[model samples]
Target chain A: MADHTATSGTNRKVCVEHLFKVFGADPADTIRRIREGAPKDRIYAETASVAAVADVSFSVAPGEIFVVMGLSGSGKSTLIRCLNRLIEPTEGRILIDGEDIVGLSADALRRLRLNKLSMVFQHFALFPHKSVGENVEYGLKVRGMAARERREKALRALEQVGLAAHADVPPANLSGGMQQRVGLARGLAVDPEIMLMDEPFSALDPLIRRDMQDELLKLQQQLRMTIIFITHDLHEALRLGDRIAIMKDGRFVQLGTPEEIVAHPADDYVAAFTRDVDRSRVFRAQSLCRDAHALSADEDAGVAAERCEALGREALFVVDAERRPLGIVRHRDLERDATATPGDALITDFPSTRGDAELVTLYGACATGLPIALLDDAGRLEGVVEPLEVFHWLGGTGAEGGGAASSGGEGEATPASAAPSETRRRDHG
Target chain B: MADRISDFYTLPLDDWIEVVVKEWLVPNFRPVFRAVQWPIDQVLGGLEEFLLWLPYPVFVVVVPLIAWRVAGGGVALFTLLSLLFIDLLGIWRETMVTLAMILTAVTFCVLVGVPLGILAARSDRFAGLIRPVLDIMQTIPPFVYLVPIVMLFGVGIVPGVIATIIFALPPVIRLTNLGIRQVQAELVEAGLAFGSTRRQLLFEIQIPLALRTIMAGLNQTLMLSLSMVVIAALIGAGGLGLTVFTGLGRLDIGRATLGGIGIVLLAIMLDRITQALGEGRHAQRPGLKESLTRWLKGLVQGSKAYNERR
Candidate 1:
């Protein structure tokens, strides 16, 4: 009996307000009590409540990445489950579009989940007895999709996730990453409006996690579906979230863009959380450079000097003949040598990063205050190293590194630089 | 060879416990249960229950209903023919009495076993504690259990039911524990996260999810009860089983065969229906049917809109 009743201002899809769920003893009765204003402590005392999810509320815009992050028990998973009433709320209301879904019948809620919302479980929850195609078509079968249509849709979904090749295989035969892709395809098969992922890639090796993230980004770009992604990995959250909500003890401690969260953390918990973050790796140089005009690449020194003399524009990107970035030549780096030509004293700094590397590794790499080079395939540079620019991007005091930023030494551009490799094995006892 | 065959069929516990444990226990816990038990328990349980309950009246109604639901009208019609053959042999009344005996015995089993199952499921220690007893209950020959039941409860349907409860209760209890334990841990967590009271989680998610397995146990119990109910007729229970036993004593193959037919009919029906209901994944998923089901008086304001929109 989900209230499908339309109201002018309320969202018609799904809304959950101040929902609380406690296990043991007629949970619906607990919700009834809570609506009537039962104290949480008393509710706990009476029902042996675990307080899985406390009063947590966040709206998902139509096409944004809203991530919920927390440790294993933080109730982030519970909160997401509450959205579709897959997990019923002990207290409060969930509105879908504009409908209060808390009271939805199991079938209605399942239909809603099937038609409008799809979730990927941490364990993948693929029916072990079903083939990949059958698993993907489960919701369609439940929705009464004809065999041909559902098969076509399932195959299409598999294709989107690059798993059409494994359509007939049992899910268990595949690796964790492949299984997760199958899970992703399963979630996408129904063409759900909101895709809810419960730590979908947490089980994958680091390398696979990044690939899956990119794959998800690509899908999100194509589908423009609102995504509520859950993860405990901070970097994963920052990598994918348009906005992230950090949760603890069944409560959201902070909610903001990764930039705001990294620079001005709400409190001690958030500050401690972001203590080791490498601002350079995460923040873009364009968003950071205070004197963009002064950074003249030595390769472009003559051109910049001509511009500065004429139009007072002091900086320019130093580049090779093919427009590959070497580094930035400040007025000083150029003035230090009168013999310096844009050719003779070309800035040797190579391109640094896409500014989306994992902050933990980037922090370690940036400790020497070196601007790590960013490169595309074929080893060509795109921009100057901006490791020092990260501190400024973080909105810390605009202090340049005390030493000259080192140009990136020769290093193989491996997936390791992005995230841990999928095949990165550890000895198990 | 004749002596050895007779003795083999009736070996005492001294010669049997090791065989039971080796043949039943180890494989059921480890590598392959069905593979091991196909030649033993399941086959034995099926054959024994069939032999004991096949000719009873309860089997008649049950077999057709089950056939109707699962195997469809053709099977139902086929099933009815086999049953009326027993009645044409004129053991219908006695078969009805045997059905009563099995139903009574099963009622007693459920009464004692369900709570025990629930208790064991709720407590690890209790479940562990019952493991040995359940195993022993399943392994010991039916006669050993009957002797004590007869001494304590006296001879009749009451004593028979008591003995049947002792024999059949373990499967239901064991399966209940197994079912509850088998419920996905995440579904329980979902229940908890949903603010489901522990009770609600147990009743709604845990119990419902565990139902198929639990139903399997119930089916086993019903089967065991029906099987044992006829044997209990030996001690003056006088059901369809009594007719079969009596016919056997008088060497009247017609009467014995008719009685056997009745019990088989009942077993088939009850087995089919319970399994059909238990295996149902969709039957229980609640939703639009309620929207379709006209509520008394009228649809709620919320429901009315749901209907209009749909």
Candidate 2:
């Protein structure tokens, strides 16, 4: 496994390129029509075929949680299954740690699955006859590990999921949440470098679903496993995905960070999905922050007041030599002490927050009606979250177009659709 | 109109069947039929000798003990009393021989049927090929094949057992196929996703879950074999079946009734035990000692109540 990783100069854990999975009698003809840009419905009408996945491509870096979100029939499940060749793709390449697995022999594919990748299913498919420990150890057993060693490793994996106590019990005896934990333990036991999860929490109750999501995040933090999570829940995608790809009709509509997606949805379908999302929870301070206007700490208070008045701002940020925020200098204070340096009258107690803080958490800081300094690591002023900007983002107004246009340039590293605004306009009409 | 319809050239279906069976099958398949009978003969001979050699007291104790373990005290008592009555009827040897035949047929049925069932469950083409064959084997009257069987293998115990096996084989195969196929597709996918080989998937996941259904098939096989015994007796197979066959030939109603009674007793005992096994109740049943203690306590209490009533 390490040798494969070493051979792959790129750091991507898994990469799929131009993958297509057409379910029909004539996949070649259907694929040809699909490549010719025929609509899925027309293709189906013409060839009597369903293109479950079409021209899909994305790469997940090591330790990144790449989420593919779509509703039923959007082909998210097919796309995930293609990663393991469970449903063999009709076209293109799937490179795992730089090794193209699309052409792997059956035995080689099995070995790859045993050593490098493990899948967690939507239904928590624990073998009913096996004990929880046995279920967890199934992958290791398939890998031909010694029985005692596999059992020990299985127990350890179960312990990681807080299910060590239930190891000896049959999986049927566990509650839904506990059974999914065993499913998770089963995946974990193999210690796969990449874990493919197909809506692992979707079958769970709402409350348990949230708990499982948190559990998965916590596990990912420790394990740093490259996870490609599939879900139909937009909220779940936003909560768990470091980068999210929204799919429709077997094609990806947009791919970006949760904040980017919530702030600047690429098309109307994506916009409609984002419309229901709680922006305060998804859009962080960094995404909402505006570039702060600051004066050097040694600048004159009179000059600062003049600069603030010229800019029509209520206050100005004061920064030291490294661009680290010293404090804010209010216009009134600068005017009151016009003879002194701006730093002398700086309000050191002004509200501030980290750039990564969610907008929900900055409501109190925003309540001060002052620009909240958004600091990055080392106390540098990355940007400022203005009170108006918070309301603008939370209000779901049309002011998002400018933000969307600005982030659109940097949001995707892949060759995503270029005419998002055009598509959005067309959809709106 | 009916005479005209009948006057249309008659297809000689019966003559064709006779030519196929007598001239073609008997001459060509005699060796194959003998080979088929070889395993049945060995198993039947061994079982019959052991059952005959075992003391009556030990057989009486052991069979009821098995029933007690598998079922409950009521079944155990029924088994014990039935076997003792068969002995009192002076047909214990005949009963053992019939039991041996039934056991041997069922054994062969499982060995042949299970792999075929697994194959049917795995492949649609194989299943399609075998489905009509299984249907014919099941729906055709048992007596229809006896002549062909006797022509091929001759009149003897092995041929009789072979006929019983053919009559009993379909249920096990059909049920085994249904059981394995009915195992949830998700479980099979899980097995594959976890990198289990096809063999491992069948044994580790499919067979274990399908065991109860397979056991139901076994019980059906046993019952069908029991029903075939009297028919098998027409071919000179020795057992209680012989007793019934001879009594029927001579119009000895008393002898026929006694033989029928003995067969029914044996059938009831075996059916109860196998059915209990199929239901998987054996795992939850109380131990024999615990059941005996509880029964004794119930008997004592019953006597006290009876005395008070008197």
Candidate 3:
């Protein structure tokens, strides 16, 4: 296995330039229409079929676990499958290291599968008949390893997933998490340079889902396989993806780092979609921190009171030892009538964000007023930030265009015209 | 027929001969197989000559080796014991003749039936055309195959071998098709992705994976051949089956018992060994039990809900 190279400057993992995948109803004609820039509606009317994925284009960087996220009917799953030619595209090019994959013959496709790619299906498609080991060994066997070697590889893959003992047994004997691990091992048995996962943990219970996520995190740390994961869950996307591509209809609305996407959503659709996220969980203190507040080396309650009145902010940053943010001092804490401190009151009444305390973590764990202080890696205070800044970064209150981002109010004709957004409409229906 | 009935194992001499002729002799000569008769006949003649020239112990070692590889140790041991029994029965040469006949029939099944099954699986037209014919081949008693076989092929090991193939070919075809069809879709995709040609996919992945199920069909075919060939004895298909049938013709119960005992031993040995081989590591691994248990539990609970819904 190659060492986990970051490939920081150049990415050659997977590239699709001018990729076109057309399915159903005279795909050739549809492609001709779509190519001539006939408006999407006119093309659809003529074809009586969708451009499930239109002339889309993107490239995933090497060693980066990029997520392609979309709600149902967005063709995200189809797009991923098209990468492996499980669902072949009708036109244009898909290149890996600048080689066109679209032109590959069946034998060539098989060779590609054997050598580089392994897929984790949404259903965790473990071969029901094989033991966990055999399931793991399947790709190895296909790639023509001897029995003993395949067995050893299978065991090693299983061990990586913390399922070494279960390798000798059937996957059916495992829990859902364990079964998913077996699927992961099966894909890993080939020692694939790239892994494609389609909503691999979507069906698991939440706790198991978290465990699977942790497992992926651990595996990615060790293996650093270039991964293109598809999912509809924003939480999942944020938690695992190094870079996220938000998709809608048949196009990508935005692609950026989780922080970038959260900080500046392309539109209201992304904003509303990311609304429920615990901001503190998604936001970093570094992004929100300002310079530490000034303070007297030694100030009594009387002097502190005068300083508080002078600054009419919602909260105050308390500094200590160094000129770094310490605990917080709320204006209200100075009033005895309120939760604020009264006459001769100090600012220590409220729970303060220690310099080292992560605002997002503290915000998630506790309900504290913002302008939360930033802290150094050690316990010393750095600066302070408003919780509202997190909301601002998420673009919950500010975003650009109206696409997948304007998830609210823009109830247009969805796939199922008659049904509201409660469910995806049966296009045929 | 009632008066002739002695036990589950025994039938009247005529009844027995009728079954062999009907089941083993006539059925093996399917139109497709017979269509290639010129080449098949030449090959068969050559093989017969070759085996005839070979010494008994050599045949003994060679035949047992085939049974051994197909199943392995237990079956191999049973094979040795069965050969010894036939030798002790004073029908060593005849039993060897029957063994040759069986080997020939099985080889025919593998050649014709496997391809037919694969074709049927790949194409609806083939399956549609063959289904009714296979159903008839299976339901008809072994005795029903005789008169036509006798008229067409003439009496001997060649004709008897023909009959045996007919009776045995259907299962191999059906199971081969079934096993191929039942292979998991993802694995098929995996094979395609990994560079298996359609032919390679079929032979390397599909066929190997399907072996356990196909072996079941093979076991059935073998057992059917062993039973049917005894009646092929009347047509001069010299084997243990014929010895038993001839013994019964003269009301020689002791001779019949020995012949019957030899068939039983051979059948048991074949069944145990093939069954063992068919017990794929996939099947023997502990996971299926858990899955089976889980499914059964789910099934029982589902039934309870079904009852409630009713």
Candidate 4:
């Protein structure tokens, strides 16, 4: 499990090891019982304590968007708060930039918060009495920065979020989305190295939420700051996360990139979440394409037909010297003119798509009955996409069935398709 | 059965309190009570002297101007009319004395109450400890504590002011604590997230947000102190209370009725002004300096236009 994390030790931005947060009178005793393999419910019944975060560990690479995705009461909120020591861990070590913060003195932890860490809250946590600019500059003011410099930094941060004009207005005067921008500006004003966002857009309207998400991505691209985003919305997790950790009952059930998780869920709990995912949008043509066998464009028609028959393919791709696809040569066309060269029998009006095109965009091209050629940036053929591959993926059983099946068999449906469709029917019905 | 119930033993709580106050508290705590009276005496004496020395005409102008700046034209007119009527009632000196007493008591209440409130707000244990003390201070009748106050501090205006302070101190403290505690939890967390110290959180976040509530508390304290004046006059505190006290004793119904009217007028003016302050409408209204400059500018411009026309 540790190997799944992209970075290790000193190179990582934030590393949490064996974190535990038990809400009760005797956390240490409860932890001991937990380590002894007592059931969570029994322990709770006996001790009346909630183990909010239980022995969770992960490392985040620098400039990575590591998302913790979970439902309410799944402890994602507790886990994010533990990162900044907002809620102190009952027992664990949290290393920020190779220094363990769990045992730091109060002053030291405060300095760490001022210098390195900032958080954006879900409810926009803006001070109602302060103007937006004042709210943005609060962190800088706490650090005792000079007035002029703090104002400049605050305005610059507000400008980054497109809210410089509203800085003088009170937070109550702004809409929810604009208030959250002020919250973001407050986190950004200090130029912290790691930003912890706890469902920062959960209170916003869906349209505004998407805009904020896009804005965050844009800002992150320019700043390259490591971000740990917590959200209960799976779509939000898939959209913003570079890597995601799916949490259930105070523990991480699976952690992987969005594609990896959608392609291969770890358990039924994870598969249940992935089942509702829009695979056409989450997946790209590159993920579904297969290696294509090509014949030289200069080859004879009789020789191309013989090669196509040997390969048991209806048509073969013809490419030039640079591997750029020229056209498709069908076995029937080649056989019709056996004495002619394959170039004379080539069909240049073949369907193709970009390598990075989403599967939804390629569905029309796939229906042309000809295998759609996936082309790279240089117009060279990367691979070919069959119609069955697109349907299998959209059919909801492609991940479990493994990569695209090459043979055209009618009975290729596996029993793995049943549960996901059952879930889908129940959800829609 | 009725005879048995009637013969049941009693606790002798009243006799026990009388013994404690007479033997232990009053004799042993005279110096402590005197020390407490010293500051109130200085403030009350200075305020009374100052108000008496100021010409009545100065107050009739300056106070209405203040009212106009904080509230609006209607309140200012009401203040002007009320002050003129009080002046006409032939109890101006007594009204000034009562104003001095109310100011002294409220000043002490605010100074002592706000800090205690902040302390209570910060710690649950402190809040729990102070809650019942505040309840007893508020619920006990003013007359009940008057005897002990007289025994310890003696019969004077200063002791009367001290009694008023004790009677009126609870609301400010309770409300201050309540206001600070009522500051939203997320705002406190945000302050902490930004690395604010405990003191910064109190001053910058908690106090500013709680200002309106605290001001409401101040208003309550002022009204309560004004109510205590009549009771304080029973122990020889001179004020409109003394006017009513003497009038009632000598059966001069007209004098007592006039004094009562004077107290009501003062209460209405103070209530209106303080209530405006608490609502914070004054923040948007022009301040005294700004209004003066703007009025001066308008007058100069009007005269210049007249000269040009000539």
Candidate 5:
């Protein structure tokens, strides 16, 4: 892991190495013992210190949303604040864009904060007495921008968050979601290269939380700013993260992309979190797709029907040499039109989705009474997404490795439109 | 039990104070004392001359207008009637003199108090040190300190102002410290994260948020100043305090009653005005009728933007 992170160090917008933040007496001594391989509990027992972030190390790539996820008191928040020296690390090197910020003088640190990084607090720490416009302009004012320029920039930032009209209103008048928007705008106004967001949406209601997540994703796409988002919500981490680091007891248990995590959780702690994830939201079409079981468009209909029957498939996808889907040909159609080629019996009404399309987007397409076609970005047939597989995965009963066959019962019955209970019955049987 | 507590060898606090004053403070602190006294005299003299010099009607009109604008019409009407009552009692001159003395003491108190408060709020060590000093300043009886002031600086309006300042300075300092300390930690963190200097954070974030509380402190200080300024009359500081004192001395009930009434009116006016300033500009927005009238006036005058903004 260290080798992997060190190789990517050149591209890192922020890199933290051996970061330890122990909150109590003689934190340095505790950090030294931790480095010497003492267990955190043992160290705490010996020193009466709580190891908040214990010997953590990671590097965030520029423009990546690196989410640090954990339960409360898991030290995820402590780790992110350590990135900007907001919570000074007990012992470590925090390099931002090749410069070590750990020992930067107060003057240099202020310059780093002003130009290189900004933070959006979890509670939307807007100045209560300041107007929304003023709140957004705060960083610029600290940088000593002229009054008129700062105002224009502040107005533009507010407009970016769809709050231009609320510029003059007090922050107290805005809802929690709107207040977080102001927080986002305030960070954006500085146009910092990286933003440390400490669970910016954790304070909002569920619906608003999702809305802010979408807004953040949209903004990230446009700005491509490096963001270190802290959250305890696994679903939120999966939804917004490019790569997520799961923290437990102030140590990162696993670090991988959302798909990697869902497909293969690192441990039972991670597995428990993934169990309740809405698989439709987390898994993409690619994860659900099985091999297309396609026949050449020129193949004889009888041959295609025989292939489908042998494979226990109800239908076959007929594709050209380039693997562009021609259409689906049901086994019955192939059997009825034995003289015709598979292309002649092809039914073009089947739904096709891209490989990267989320299962939520594939739900309607998959419900068309025919097997859903999963295609690559070039429109080449990838595979078919079976409804039974989707239900099993979403219901958290499916194994991580797919293609586990159901035993006994429903031997010849088509399983595509089977209710979830029927699919479970087949599986248990 | 008392003898056991004292150990029959008690040190004399007053003798120590006397020795320290004569031996240490008199020779080393005389110039500092004179320097401080100069400003108090200048401000008191300037304000006294101005207040007494103003045409009575002009002063009365201006005060009522300020009251109307700041605290609204009810307080404005009260101010007008109260001033007129003082005038009828023929102590308006004396009332203005008392106002001057209170104003001078408050100015000095604010100048000294706010900085000490900010210092206390910033540093834990300073706060710890200043806490007991503030307690002593507050708890010591005014007459007890007046004796020391008379012995050191002699009796005059300046000494009286000094005495009043010592008594009234604690609240402004305490409240300012409290206000800044009570500012939300997250806001302070936000300021720091954005690269604000210690000075910038104090002025831009902490002070503005603490304004209302600081103003409450000022209000307390002003009221304290009024009461102490009255007591300072025993040291020969002339104002309404002298009238009340003279009235009491010769058993002149009517005179003392008039003087007491003037101080009450002056206290109410100052309290209402300063309280309004502390509450911020829009906090005392006029009633619906006045707002409607202002809106209509703006509409008739065709100041479209102004009316809409309100």
Candidate 6:
């Protein structure tokens, strides 16, 4: 168990290995078929069982936010519940703090849930008969906490979620968002090291959903608990995930940071997800940066002009000896200043952006038509970001426009849509 | 031809049952029945004598006060007028005896039924096993079993109370089972997830949520007990039921009418009070004793919270 690192280090807070949950009378044959790589439909046709969760494995680092993103029925919720042993796995090893919780005695599992882990449900499972305070105090009460201490702790937890005044109110009186806050407070009251949030905000309206997301981010920053959040919304996943694992038909299609997923989706399914994403918000200037070939201010302009023509580049950043961008030297200007130095051909006051600026903010910078000089923190030139290259990277729909459609006619649509973006990149590369 | 057709199919079901029950079941179970009867008689007799010992006006006043506390002013006034009318008819002793018998039967029903109901709720196999038995118990006419109970335990208030208990027990058990089962599954899961023991989860979460349903079951049990207690008077249980029985035997219309009025008034009053308590309306006013106990609980709670903060 110690030797088997799920996907990362042995120090991981949660590790799930080869988990399988088949929903039917005879799971053994179906599981065997699944293990041999038979797809869900074929296995269901043969064995009369739905493999709700297939052979899935991932580990969450201590204090890391791991989001499992998938559509409904994709087994994301089932997979997370498997971690806490809420849904008993038909086959797997779930190691929480290096202890295999799947094999724990009932008492030990209860203790783990009480002291080490907590969960938030999608529908906010607050006790209808209990007040918000009592709901929060539930874990403490189960642990045999003194009534007063539990009350104090519950109040403190409520205060953390900005619902202190509502401690005595029944959960039914609160709206959906507030009720979810109560659920969060209940989970928080226990002070568990890990929180299994199963689509905690999915039941709210869009406005409340966004508000709750911000509140969760704030809470996570202060608490730093390892969170395994499940959601079907790609936008929510991108917003909250430090690292996301995209699930499809009970298997992870890809796992990476949000930027990595948006910029380089692994397949057609992932690219289909990317098409709906607001690309400007997801990609930063660094993602679109190209290597900036700079001419030194002292370099001769006739040579600069020929170099630009040979390279088929439209412009160059005129930089000092220290490589700090002074200004752009357009190809036309360089040609006009035949014997003059590159500095004499320089067109100063070009629009520039910091490497960390989002592409959305850099659109106006790109409107100036000269290459946008991408600078690092100390104002040194990192790269030149041309508007056309930015458009190509943003407009093209990831791997779908490339390798995924390799099967003849399917490839036709891929290249046809990619044609315009590719032309733009070529014209401006 | 018709006579032959009717006679040809006669099965002697009555003779066979009579022989089996009277010759076999009664002889074997008689001692067990007698042993159980001793306690029921003692409890019923003691309660009846105590209620008889209370002066009529005092009894009327105390009962109405209890009614007022449980069901509010209007029901209490109704109870007062009803009891005064029963006293005016000079059948207060019989009314007291009837009340005692009904109380004892309902109490025994609750004590036996609730735990069995909980057991049924907790296990599918147990519930399945009990379902057919409860169905048979509920479906059998009460008078049919009263004869067998009298045969085993002999005719008296003891046998009467025993029969009343049997007739009343089914509803409480069925309702308790239904109530526990009706508790939201999510709440039970929450309780288990928070480390509550099986017992704690049952008492703290399931029971509290199912409280209203369980109370409704209790109210049904109480009403059934009252009905059965009156019917038990035929076996010499002696109460307002005996008064009505004796009055009807002599064809004395006025006496029977007065006894009938007493039963209706008692039934309505008891039903309303229990139902009110079940609905949690009785908690609207805390008596001095209850308030004192609550204050003490508050103190303990406060100190515990203070210590926890430290």
DockQ per candidate, 2 decimals: 0.04, 0.48, 0.22, 0.54, 0.57, 0.45
Q: Looking at model 6 chain B, report the run of 10 residues with the lowest lDDT sum.
A: B280-289
CA deviation > 4 Å runs, candidate 6? A1-8, A36-48, A260-273, A289-358, A369-385, A398-429, B1-70, B281-310
- Report the Cα RMSD per candidate: 17.1, 8.4, 15.0, 6.5, 7.0, 6.9
Q: Can you write out model 5's per-residue Cα lDDT over A1-429, one digit (the tens) per residue?
A: 334345446777778878889899998788788778787789888999988998888888788788999999899888887887778888878888877788889899999989988999989999987889999999999999999999999999998889999998889999999999999999999999999899999999999998888888778767889899999899999888878899998889998877667766899999999877877776666556677778887788788888999878888888889998989998888777678888787798888876566677866875776788877658898788776676666665564434234312223212221211111111111
DockQ of candidate 6 is 0.45
Cα lDDT of model 4 by residue, A153-177, tens digit: 9999999999999988889999999
- The C-alpha lDDT values of all candidates are 0.66, 0.85, 0.70, 0.85, 0.85, 0.82
Q: Residue pairs in steric clash, candidate 2?
A: none
**How well is each residue in B2-91 modelled by candidate 5, as lDDT tens digits?**
658568777799889899989998889888888888988999999999999999999889999988888788889989998899899899
What's the lDDT of the predicted structure labeled candidate 6?
A: 0.82
**Residue A202 alpha-carbon offset, candidate 3, angstroms:** 3.4
Using DockQ as the measure, name the better of candidate 2 and candidate 4: 4
Who is ahead in DockQ, 1 or 2?
2
Candidate 5 Cα misplacement greater than 4 A, ranges: A1-8, A36-46, A289-318, A328-341, A363-371, A383-388, A395-397, A403-429, B1-13, B280-310
Cα DockQ of the candidate 1 complex: 0.04
Best by DockQ: 5
lDDT over C-alpha atoms for residue A336 of model 5: 74
Better candidate number, 3 or 5, judged by DockQ: 5
lDDT of 1 at A82: 77
lDDT (tens digit, per residue) of candidate 2 on A170-247: 788889999999999999999989999999999999999998988888887778899999999999998888789999
lDDT tens digits by residue: candidate 6, A314-357: 99988887889988888997676587778776789898987656
